[model samples]
Target: MPKNVLILHASPRLNGNSQTLAETFAAGAEAAGHWVSRISLAQAQISPCQACGYCRGHQHRCRLEDDMDKIYPAILGADCVALAAPLYFYDWPAQLKLAIDRLYAFGPEYSIRDKETVLLMTAADQNPQSFGGAEATYQLALVDYLRWRDRGRILVGGLNEAGAIEGHPALIDAYKLGYTI
Candidate 1:
């Protein structure tokens, strides 16, 4: 069955490893007949959540008028949401974090809660715990709190420089993940 997949590329670098991974995933997804829409926070004009309670009883609509307004509509109609980013201080980059926090506008019953969510993180450190922060947040917020279905997560480490992950096997895994999704 073909599904709508919304991919959020939260890496700051224009051609970072995480971005590459996202492209690979999109390729596989498109090849499998699924529609893929991407939002690059680095280039997108997204604003942080104001927490003014505009979304409360507002049909999951945020009051802030920014790029997220467009993203919100796509998210509401997507079957899967894929997040790809690099670990900045063990957490997502500032832009990515902001975009995610802004997603709170999606009311509990609308769309996000039932869609499948995927994560891909790249880190400079090779420690096994490099992904702890992101993994914990993903598990807690997306899985536990939002009640979204878990597709899977791909964490690639030891690649700080742009293009360092050029030939990494994780890229292949990312593509396969999308292919199977």
Candidate 2:
């Protein structure tokens, strides 16, 4: 059966390496008949979670309304969520992290356990340690805490300039990840 996959493009730069990888992944997923929706976090107006304990009393409805209103439904409807981001100072961009932090609105009933997840990342640094922080966070937060199934990840390094990842082999890897997910 086909799955509903949501691709969160967390890179602020348009057509950047990370976004390109995500688009390639989406293409393969589409070819394989899975429904894919790509959301650019840069364009979203999501606010940081205030840790205000509003959802607990309000039946999971967040008090501060913003673009998360749209994201909540998208997440609830997705069978898989793919996060594509570039390593900035060894971590995810603020846009993606903020959106994720807002997920606390769901509280204990968060739509996390059932969904499969993917991580696609790029970095200018070729050192393996460059990705350690991101990998650890992904494992600890999304995989361990939320219990989201690990689908696949494509981490490409040494791509700093614009369009640097255009001809990179990771594109094929990303496509394969999406196709096989």
Candidate 3:
């Protein structure tokens, strides 16, 4: 079945390595006949969650008025959601974190339950432990609590320079992963 995949690209840099991987994954998904859409956080005006309990009411909608309004619909419509970002200080970029926090609006409605979640992460270090933080977040928030299916993960490391991720084996792996979806 062709799936609607929503990829959230959270690299602050234009054409950053993580963003490139996201493009590659999207291309592969599209080639496989799946519909893919990408939201670049660098260009979006999303705000962090205020931790207010407004969404907990019967509305099931976020009260904060921001660019996240554009994202919520895509998130709800997607059969698969991929979060792509470079590791900054052992975690994803703050922009992505903010959007993620805002997903609290969906909790009241369980809108994201049963969705397939994929993680696309890049880091400057080659150490495997560098990805622990994002993985922990995925496991705790998406997998354990939200009950989203764990689709797959592509973690590319030791890439700092712009476009350094090109020609890397992981890029092909990412494409293949998406194709299989």
Candidate 4:
């Protein structure tokens, strides 16, 4: 069956390494007859969550309006969600982190649960430990807390320059992950 896959491309650079991976993944998923939607976080207008507890009282509707208003519906309708971003300070970018925090609106009543998720991360550091923080966030928040299933992850390191991951094998892995998901 065809599935709805939402990819959140959180790279600062428009044509950066991680965006390449995300586009390649989208290609493969489309080839496999799945519906794919992608959002560039750098081009989005998302605000940080205020933690005002408005959603809890307002029937899961966030009080502040921004790009998350669109993202929330996308997430609710998606069967799979993919996070593609470069590692920043050994973890996800602050923009992506803020977007994730805004998801607190979906709570005990309406929640994002049981969805399949994928991670495509790139880092300039070659050290495997560089991805530890991002991986931990993915595992704990998406998998454990939201109960989303892990589709796959492609962590590409040692990529510093723009378009560095163009000819990389991680792109192939990302494509396969999308197709197989």
Root-mean-square deviation (CA) per prediction: 1.3, 0.9, 1.1, 0.9
* lDDT (C-alpha, whole model) for all candidates: 0.87, 0.91, 0.89, 0.91
Better of 2 and 3 by TM-score: 2
Tens digits of lDDT, candidate 1, 1-181 = 9999999888779788999989999888999999999888888898888888789878777888889877887878889999999999888788778888987787555456778999988999999698998899999988888888899899999998999999899989989999999
Q: How many clashes show up in model 4?
A: 0
Worst 10 residues of 4 by lDDT: 105-114
Candidate 2 lDDT by residue in tens digits, 23-134: 9999999999999998899889998898889899998899988988999889989999999999999998898999989888877876557989999999999987889999
**Candidate 2's TM-score:** 0.97
Off by over 4 Å in 4: none
| Residue-level lDDT for 152 in candidate 4 | 91
Alpha carbon deviation, residue 140, candidate 3 (Å): 0.9
Candidate 4 differs from the real structure by a C-alpha RMSD in angstroms, to one decimal, of 0.9
Better TM-score candidate (1, 3) = 3
lDDT of 4: 0.91
Give per-residue CA lDDT, model 4, range 1-181, as digits (tens): 9999999999889899999999999999999999999888878899888989999999899999888889998999999999999999999998799889988999864468969999999999999889999999999999988899998989999999988987898888888888888
For all predicted structures, in order, the TM-scores are: 0.94, 0.97, 0.96, 0.97
**Model 3: colliding residue pairs:** none
lDDT of 1 at 31: 91
Of 2 and 3, the candidate ranking higher by lDDT: 2
